[model samples]
Target chain A: MQPYNYPSKYLENAVEEFAKLPGIGRRTALRLVLHLLNKPKEEVEQFSATLNEMVQNIHFCSICHNISDNDICSICSSTSRDKTTICVVETIKDVMSIENTMQYKGLYHVLGGVINPMEGVGPADLNIESLVNRLKSNDINEVIMALSATTEGDTTNFYIYKKIKDYNIVVTTLARGVAFGNELEYTDEITLGRALLNRVKFNNSFSVE
Target chain B: MQPYNYPSKYLENAVEEFAKLPGIGRRTALRLVLHLLNKPKEEVEQFSATLNEMVQNIHFCSICHNISDNDICSICSSTSRDKTTICVVETIKDVMSIENTMQYKGLYHVLGGVINPMEGVGPADLNIESLVNRLKSNDINEVIMALSATTEGDTTNFYIYKKIKDYNIVVTTLARGVAFGNELEYTDEITLGRALLNRVKFNNSFSVE
Candidate 1:
């Protein structure tokens, strides 16, 4: 590993900060930092100021735990949204993803994260208690678990199910089957098997009218 | 072109700012901004603060135009560096790339960018005047044009050559060759032809002792 010969301390510090991001490596970080140097001084200042403003002023929705500008998120407060159905998701990104489909209109309950024992995350660390409280007092008819297909996701879903099973509300999980655009021959055996066993009528399968 | 339903204005603004950077798309920008929300608040503050510090305080070397902490960069002020030679490059990143090679110890003259008529960047937009002034005042013995292998690079090199052709100094360009570790079968015609025409002595080809 040959050492970098950065010409200035300020440039080096900026690169190190960018490299701390999730997928940005040192070289990409250096490239991004240098790009900022070429931008207008006011633009760069605005970039930093905006980041600071986000970290300082951003809030988490009290009802759903989604990142928000106020105590309640836009989805949670909207009058037109389906208040009877609640979708349990892992993060705010998932909420946006579901919203992009223009399919689901129900309000969301963000769990912050799933149960991953290896990472020391458990039900207590999530928003499970608040979720249970919401179900206890609200007229919610169904709770849909929209987690990933990983083992951790299953474990989290099972744990949440146990906590809310006694309630009169219906509990369901996202459909597991062959995905659209994926060839049937290339689909994993488990997914293909599930798709076959839970096949919907041909007319109901397609999204086109 | 579906509209994004970002829950918070701050998050949306941050994503827009991150997307403005080179190579970063809107989806990647959202992921990165969410990643920052997970990091400790102090860490996020430090990240923004470092960026602000860089844009406000970083300087360009008065002698070489390279980025520096002071008016005179460390390379220009060093006693052990070879002051009789100058490597003319296009940007600070190029300066670091050459420095990382551990081969060249000469000072650099950053041209900011190559001559590109399409972008309206001309010779006057670069640091050619400062380089000329340095050549006039110093006892330089060689000038290396280490620009890219493009029409713009060649135009810049030829333009610089014309400016200092009468000086008592050697003007050289980097040898064009097939990149190390690249298969010759896949090398492009122009590069392969250049490699053959400009083949180096076998004894001086590699870095191994």
Candidate 2:
């Protein structure tokens, strides 16, 4: 390689690392690298420190599995929220979507991922066991399954519905206002609100108990 | 204020800092912040260490004024490059532009910036004096002015041209193919290649000795 007069190995490595992020291409990565190089040394240092610190500080809360730095997430620990009603979601992004509406006064439980058999993500692969355990231990009255409208999402909802039906807790799914195969993450407030408004109770088919 | 579950003030501060980067809005910044959270503890430490190492390792070359991990840059130290010719540029990005073509095999001198009266950039503001001193001390045959075609760029070129003309050195500009008022960073290869090939010798009133 022709010798680069200005060689910044750290910048080169950091750019390579940044290019691995979703939606960040090579040219954009290079532009970012150049921009970082131009920044005051203190600012660049702070940027890197911030990235590392954020990663080290935040983690999945044990109670709700939502991203948090504490043992229990903010939503899970809050007394203001309806603790008896749990809004279950596939990811933290879905939680944010629901939270943005300022309508969800209920607590949350993140499933971590949807049950996709094709992707080898069965009920066992998700945090479904923990959710079931939480329902058994807590005084949860209603369990709302706010998963995506996809085939996998349906499969996960049914699986969850069968497990929790034995309990007196009312298991409800979001209304069919969401488009078929559309993820809950992409759904807007209006559609999500409609879905929430028209939720139906799911009957337990497997559990005769 | 909403209770942010992620309690580390330093971590939160860093995330806020990274959120200021171009194209990185708040949501994406949160994603990155979460991604860092998922990384192994050692890997997170390594990322921080890398940034600190970069700051400690990199330094500006005293001769060509290019960033390097050494006192003298690789281009300046290399015996293979054309030493008789020095390609003078506004920034390190300009140097990369010329290097990317793989056409120019000469040494370089980075002026840091061009003369912009509006930006308060004058002859003394740039690294012009060092460049002039280099010409006076060395047996330099040609000094190619690869500045932008902006009004400010032209002013800087005129100022540098006068000083270099006093020495018995051939001073040239990077041709008129570059569009008027355009920055060198955006010029395409074909246009830049044609410009380099069609470079005209400066024949101003103040002729070279």
Candidate 3:
């Protein structure tokens, strides 16, 4: 094929960058770039500015490790939310998923990552220490481990449980709304619902209540 | 829905901003925001930078009106490309589609938009004057109208034909590779090919080839 004669090398460069986005292929990326080119100057400017603003403005809430524009996330700062109970999640997406159900009003503590030795991630790499610290100082009554039901998730859950056992907090996990081997990100609302409903006690080993 | 306890109001604000994308709805925008949140900090930073760079660096080629970072677009600047023939397209995406096939060797002239009365776009608003000027000065021989086969596209074509009739240049349009009312943006490669091959000569008041 002949080399492409893009209007701007930078436009082409941007297309290449967009191509790296999940689910975007080369042709689609090119199409998107061309579409952007056809747009009025102000529209393209807004599109670019929005992306830039998102990155420059948004940040992780230091307390819950959830996304925020400030030091303390909205949920953590809200006086109405139950502060004594913290729902543990592997990622911020999981927090959104749980929030979507409108079932949980407790606080959240994002692990940022799970314990996956295969990926070179260990216990020390996660936000486990912060969670333990929260349990130690606060009147936290329960810790709901709402991680995915994958082997990696189970390992991470167990690891966190061990670290937090010394604290007299009631530790529970989301009932099995997730199917085996599925990541929390991909699990549908129904399955996640079932898993949450079926959550059994974490008695050093995983078993249905 | 209950007020989404998004980690941050800024995150919610960003999600609202993304929701304004052409085809994205609130849910999809939210999904995209969560996806970006999950990305590594460096990747997110790079994504933000890419948008800024694209907006700040990209420009339209003065000659062909194609998007570019320089005074001339790549196609317009290249020595190998046929500068004598200009392919008139409704949008820049049409240019890429034609370029990808490696069949057309001519430079491009992005109209920026098609004539659509419903949308309040008309001839006076288009870059028709520059096109007429290009024909007057350049060694341009043939002007191929590769606009979509929609009523709006036809309206733009006829309007352009009237303006350029006095220039004594060959005027041709994409032989109907697209179906009636189907946007050029949606036409697949094969159909576009068939249409390109079947293009015919166009005139304002006569069907003369």
Best by the lDDT measure:
1
Give the runs in model 1 whose Cα sits over 4 Å from its true position. A207-209, B206-209
* Candidate 2 Cα errors over 4 Å, as ranges: A1-6, A117-120, A175-209, B1-11, B178-209
Give the Å shift of residue B148 in candidate 1.
0.6
Using lDDT, rank the candidates from best to worst: 1, 3, 2
lDDT of 1 by residue, A95-145 (tens): 998999888989899999999999999889999999999999999999999
Error of 1 at A41 (Å): 1.5
- Per-residue lDDT for A1-209 in model 3, tens only? 35565656677787787677666666667776666655576776666556556767787788888887787887899999999899999888788889988778999999988898899998899998888888888899999999887889989888888988888888998655465688989988877777677776678335322
Cα deviation of B166 in candidate 2 (Å)?
2.6
State which docking tier applies to candidate 1.
Answer: high
TM-score of 2: 0.78
lDDT of 3 by residue, B43-160 (tens): 7667656766777778778988777678787788899998889999867667877987777899888887898889888887778889989999988889999888777888888999
Candidate 1's DockQ: 0.87
Recovered native contacts, candidate 3: 0.49
